[model samples]
Target: MPWCSTARLLHLRSGAAQLDRLEKGTTGLGTADALLALDCSAERHHVGTFQVPGDVNDLDFPLPGVRLESTNVIEGDGANGVACITRITTGPGVTDYVTHEQECTYSTFGIHVGQGDRLAFFGEGQNISVHLSDCRNDVGRPGAEITIGLAVSPYRVLTIPKGVAHTLDGLGGVVTRDEPVW
Candidate 1:
């Protein structure tokens, strides 16, 4: 199952998954103790310190026609570590393909896709290698987290597609809905 909300802001702690968009006046949401919001909308994707939870991996994406803007991972008190993202794609008359593994560390790394790109995180792991590729014109199950800024004209409804989910392994925290940024 998947969690869906249209509230301005949404926070998920204790390993929760979500999908929705932030209202015009919202600054987005936050997660502690390792939280992940798939296809979650807000100003950006923010992560905090905590151990990786065992149940925070492998989530399916629920929507299509959504593009991921970027992702960032900040380091905690722990020594240098690594995280990996495997992208799998499928569609009508479309063949399933794998994206070169995407990896990032607490060293502040991220990925950027153009407008209308469909992709998902297949898996996340520690000490993973770095690979980069694009999804061209396909979609797949959700597998990762962070913030996403949509690429469309103004006056358009901001919608987060399904088929994606976010998860933090550890470091549980609180999630707030419709919270002010300033």
Candidate 2:
């Protein structure tokens, strides 16, 4: 018989949110627990089960003053597929966090865990990965008002931070290094 799992979510005013897919099945046979949290150091409260293949960026989460931190895929069905986390600037240009297919397996990743306006999800399949997207609302604040687009692509969009360059390390993950220009 298929089993269900608990879920939790935490949203930070700084543009960060934590999501827990506690226990998910390969074919989405089990249930999930979703929670919304405020502030990176605050407690996580139960929200509800997420609709797989649903638009997560449209969710009306409370407390819009907190910054997001990371997307933690704690535990779930172990499968090999691709997941993308993209960071779109409010004006122009875009960044690709993780676009490699078959890379977002049961493993964990935090692509551009930072602040933005939207976050889209494009799982190789309709299965939800146990992960979190970190974010921070430190970009345009105080006196100056600016907004950025964090589109999680109903398909997948991962972004590398601006001004910082990355190189693929040994584990197929990007390694950050200081560079004078992109």
Candidate 3:
């Protein structure tokens, strides 16, 4: 559930809880009243967005991981919950395959950032198989920060970029299985 928006929305509708990411937006920063959508087809590397549906705008419910930039769309609220669109790096590891934990991996896909900021690289670069962490506060401040906690299955990946400051929980281990073909 870390960066999988489509999956979570389905869970929300089926279950009986809700979550949200942002209360409003900055420079088109947050949520809107459109269908839950995540698209990456333009020139931007990590650009992603969630659109509120056209029928359920007036629905009053909090959706976590959503940062409203312009104004909430006037319609569309088929469901209620928080949604995150993440772009995690997936590549060969040093020895075996590893899963990217959702707790520490902040997947920001197609979102632009300045060079001054550093990316939080998770997964293993060499063979050690590590839960990567870098001390770089890229999350601007106050209203600019977007943080959300989710329950998700494990995944394997390399660099992970968080929009703000985050702490990494490391799980050091050895990889005996060279590289996975899948």
Candidate 4:
């Protein structure tokens, strides 16, 4: 059974705002080693790392609407299946958003980008940005405030660990899905 089940829409104004919240430590996003043990499969997706060009001030901040789809698994074989699914949709002119998983549960974030839209990941501390494609490609400089471009795909899922504050930039008309595992 799922330990937590909740969902809500996050209307994010800018990446700067999200970064500020993370720096202030008010967002309540974090990571843990115990949670890392739950998802060993994530290691294969860990991939390589790269540095983000320019600074956070160089990008255009767009307003993005993020639909949080957190659902409880009513029935499943183990941790690999789900019997029920939930979805939420938003209107145009809504883009760019940020979110974090709760302390104990790990979340798999999937992003599907629309035309003229791009996505990047910003993690607190030493956490690196990841991109999922045919091969693993990790972007962003460790401990630096930078935005790295993430390719859009249904198969691209970033496993977010506990205690790690993270947010995405340039999610215009993008579909963001969050599946939390405990």
Model 2 alpha-carbon drift over 4 Å, by segment = 1-40, 52-58, 62-89, 100-114, 130-182
lDDT of 1: 0.25
Give all TM-scores, in the order shown: 0.17, 0.28, 0.17, 0.26
Q: Residue 7 deviation, candidate 4, in Å?
A: 23
lDDT of all predictions, in order shown?
0.25, 0.27, 0.24, 0.30
Highest-lDDT candidate? 4
For candidate 3, the 10 contiguous residues with the lowest summed lDDT are 39-48
Ranked by lDDT from best down, the candidates are 4, 2, 1, 3
The TM-score obtained by model 1 is 0.17
Per-prediction CA RMSD (Å): 18.0, 17.8, 21.1, 18.3
Model 1 poorest ten-residue lDDT run: 173-182
Best by TM-score: 2
lDDT, residue 129, candidate 2 = 27
Error of 2 at 107 (Å): 6.6
Pairs in clash, predicted candidate 4? 30-162, 30-163, 30-164, 31-162, 31-163, 31-164, 63-95, 64-95, 64-96
Which regions of candidate 4 fall more than 4 Å away from where they truly are?
1-147
Residue 174 displacement (Å), model 4: 0.2
Q: After superposition, how far is residue 67 of candidate 2 from its true place, in Å?
A: 14
